[model samples]
Each structure stands twice: as structure tokens, then as C-alpha cells.
Target: MRLRYTTLVVDDYDAAITFFVDVLGFELVEDSPATTSTTGAAKRWVVVRPPGADTGLLLARADGERQRAAVGDQFAGRVGHFLEVDDAAAEYERLVALGVEFEGPPRVEAYGTVAVFRDVAGNRWDLLSGP
Candidate 1:
């Protein structure tokens, strides 16, 4: 079976959408009205994904203080997400030009070339290439 979407808590929906669509070159798969399953509060069902990727990200806005605090630290300050690309250096440069913040320059690892960068929500992601 294939994986579906992963929930990404964000501070704002439109801002997250802009970052994924305009900056990261992902497609907006869906952005429809929804509600919280627990409280039936109004919410949104927003999904974004890389052009040819099977798994997309569900952008869920922070609903409360606890969720809000988790928005950028979902992985507890570790590099939690990975964005694989064909050319790590090129993608790194492009993202830098687009104002994406990188922790450091690209470096080579035994497995691949990679660079860590923070997403719009401050979650660290590895811009990776190679095997």
C-alpha cells in the first residue's frame, strides 16, 4: 500500500500554502472547507505535494496553544523532514535565492549530498540528492 498525506501543523494556512506552492514548487492538491473531528470547529483541508510525488502534506492550522507551540517544532528541533531532489546544489541555491534559511552549505555524505534548511514553519528539512 502507498502512503497518503502527513499532517503538518502551521500557524497560518495561506502562508503555508504560499510557501509550498510558490517557494517549494509543490502543487496545491486541495483546499476545501473542513472541521475539527473532536470539536466540530471550522477548519480547512489543505494539501500540497511535489509535482510527481505520491505523498502529499496536509497543512493543518494550529487549533490551540499546544498545537500552536508545536507548529515549528513538530520534530523537536531535529531535521525531521526530507525533500529529495535530483540536484541538491541547484535546489539549495534556488531555495536560498527564494529566502529559504539554510543551517549550513551543502555537504557530501556517504549516502548523498545534502543541506539542511528550515521550512516556512521553522521545521528543519534536508535538501537531499543521490542515493
Candidate 2:
């Protein structure tokens, strides 16, 4: 078996969807009906992925105060997610053009080219190019 999806908590579905789909160029894999219980707010099982990635992200909107508090702080204000791309510089430029919030300037290291950026929800992610 293989891992399928990881979750990213957000404030709203459509806003999150737009960022990943429009800004990041992720493919919309699925947006279907979902229910947490018999009596609760309606929800959607939203998932998205890169053009050719096996793993996808489950965009889970915050359902309550607890989950809402977790939004943007999922990574504890650290660069916990690394999005490996073909070219960090190119992607960086595109994201900048789209007005994506980046932590700082891209820097080259022995491991690879990497730049820190914040997702729509404020979680930090590193865009890296290397092994």
C-alpha cells in the first residue's frame, strides 16, 4: 500500500481551492460530498495534487474552534513542508508574480536550492530543487 493524502486545514474551501489550483497550479483531483456525522454542517472531500504526483493533499476546512485554531499554525510556524520542484528559481518567480507570500529570499545550500514560502493558511513550506 501507499500513502494517498495529507491534510491541510483551512478557513474556507473555495479560497483554499483557488490558491492551490490557480496560484500553485495543482490539479483538482476530487471535490465530492463528505459528512462527519448525521447531524452537522455539510462538507466536501476536497483533494488536489501536482500534475504528476502520486500523493495529494486533502484540503480540510476548519470545522470548529479547535480546528480553526490549528489553521495557519499546523507546522508550528516552521518550514515543515518541502515542495520539491524541477526549478526553484522559476517556480519562485511564478509564485511572486501571483503574489504568493514568501518568507525570505531563495538561498542555495549544499543540499539544494530552497526558498521558504507561506501557504494560504499561513503554514510554511520550502520550495527545493535537488535530491
Candidate 3:
């Protein structure tokens, strides 16, 4: 079976949404309902999909203490996921022009050229292109 969707927990939902949508060219599909309580304040979820791509991402709230801690430990200075692209260098350049910052330049690897970048909330992602 094919994979459906992947979820990422971020501290700032709007910034994360903006980065994925504006910088990476992903399309927004949904925005979470506004939260009322202090504990839930700024808590929201967003969904986005890559341009012309069926698979998508779910931007979830990193609100709960347990979840926030878990996300911090799991994704700390690490890529949340790796996305395959037609040309890693081209895509990296395009994203850089859109104000996206790269942790390292694209480099050739055994399977492809891989470049690391951060989302708005400092979540890492890898852009890959097969050699």
C-alpha cells in the first residue's frame, strides 16, 4: 500500500505553514480551529501538499507537554523527513531564492544528492535527487 500522509509537530504553526506553503511551494489544504485556553493558545494544525503532488503533510500543534518533549527529543537537530526531487541542486537553489536557508549545500551521496534545510520552527528536511 502507498503511504498516505506524514505529520510534523511544530512550536509555531503559522510560521511553519508559511514556510511550507510560501517557501517550499506546498499548497495549504486545511487550517486548525483557533484555541481558547492558555494551554491551548496558539494551538493549531495545518495541512499542506507539494505542488502537483498527491501525498501531503499535516502540521500538528506541539502543545501538549508530553508531545512537545517527545518532538524535541526526536527531531532535535535532525531531519523530520526526506523528500525526493527531480534535481536536488535546482530545487535547493529555488528554495534558497525563496528565502529558505540550507544547513549544508547539496552533496552527492550513494543514492542521490542530498541537501539539508530547516522549516520555520527549525525542523530539518532533506531534499534528495537520485544520481
Candidate 4:
């Protein structure tokens, strides 16, 4: 079976949508009201995807303390996500111009060219492209 979406917890839905759509250049695939929970809080099922990607990201809002704490530390401060690009250098330069903060500069490796950058929520992501 093919994987569809991976959940990325966020502090706010609109903010996450803004980052994914406006900053990262993803398309908002869905944003509809979700099933009501026991807590009686309003929730929405949000999904976003890259320009032409098969897999998309599901944005989940922090509902409690534990979830809130995990907003930016989903993978405990490691490079938890990766976006394979057509050109690492070009993407790096474009992201930099848009004010995205990267952990360091892009470097070529035996497998590919890669650079580490942070999402708006501070989750680390690797932008890479094969040689």
C-alpha cells in the first residue's frame, strides 16, 4: 500500500497553513472540520503537499501540554523530515532569499547534495538532491 500523509503537529492551524502554503510553497489540499473530540474544542483536518508530490503532510494542532511541547521537537531535535528537490543548491538559494533559516550551508555528499533547514515551527528538514 502507498503511504498518504504524515502528521506534523503545529501550534496553530492558520499559522501552519501559512508556513506550508506561503513560505514552503506547498498547496493546501484540505482544511475541513474534523470530528469533535471529548475536550469539545474546535479542530480541523488540514493537509498540505508539495507542488507535485504524491505524499502530503497532515497538520495537527497541539491540543494539550504534551502535544504543545512536541510542536517543534517532534523528532527530539533531529533532522526528522526530508524534502527531495530537483536541485539542492537552487532550492537552498531560493529558501534563503525567502528568509528561511538553515542549520548550515548545503554540502555535497557521496550520495547527493544536502542542506539542513528549519521549518517555521523549528522542525529540522533536509533539502537534498542526488548527483
Measured against the true structure, the TM-scores of the candidates, in listed sequence, are: 0.97, 0.95, 0.78, 0.94
Expressed as tens digits, the lDDT of each residue in 1-80 for candidate 4 is 89899999999899889988998899999999975576777899999999989899999998889899999999998999
Model 1 Cα lDDT, one tens digit per residue, 17-122: 9999999999999999999999999999999999999999999999989999998999999998899999999999999999999999999999899999998999
Ranking by lDDT: 1, 2, 4, 3
* Model 3 C-alpha lDDT per residue in residues 22-69, reported as the tens digit of each score: 888789988868774765565565789987877788777776787677
Report the number of the highest-TM-score candidate.
1
**Which is the winner by lDDT between candidate 1 and candidate 4?**
1
* Candidate 3: worst-modelled 10 consecutive residues by lDDT: 36-45
Candidates in order: C-alpha RMSD to true structure: 0.8, 1.3, 3.2, 1.2
CA error at residue 53 for candidate 1, angstroms: 0.6
In model 1, the Cα lDDT at residue 24 comes to 95
Error of 4 at 8 (Å): 0.4
Cα deviation of 7, candidate 4, in Å? 0.4
lDDT for each candidate structure? 0.96, 0.91, 0.79, 0.91
Model 4, clash count?
A: 0
- Pairing residues by index, what is the TM-score of model 3? 0.78
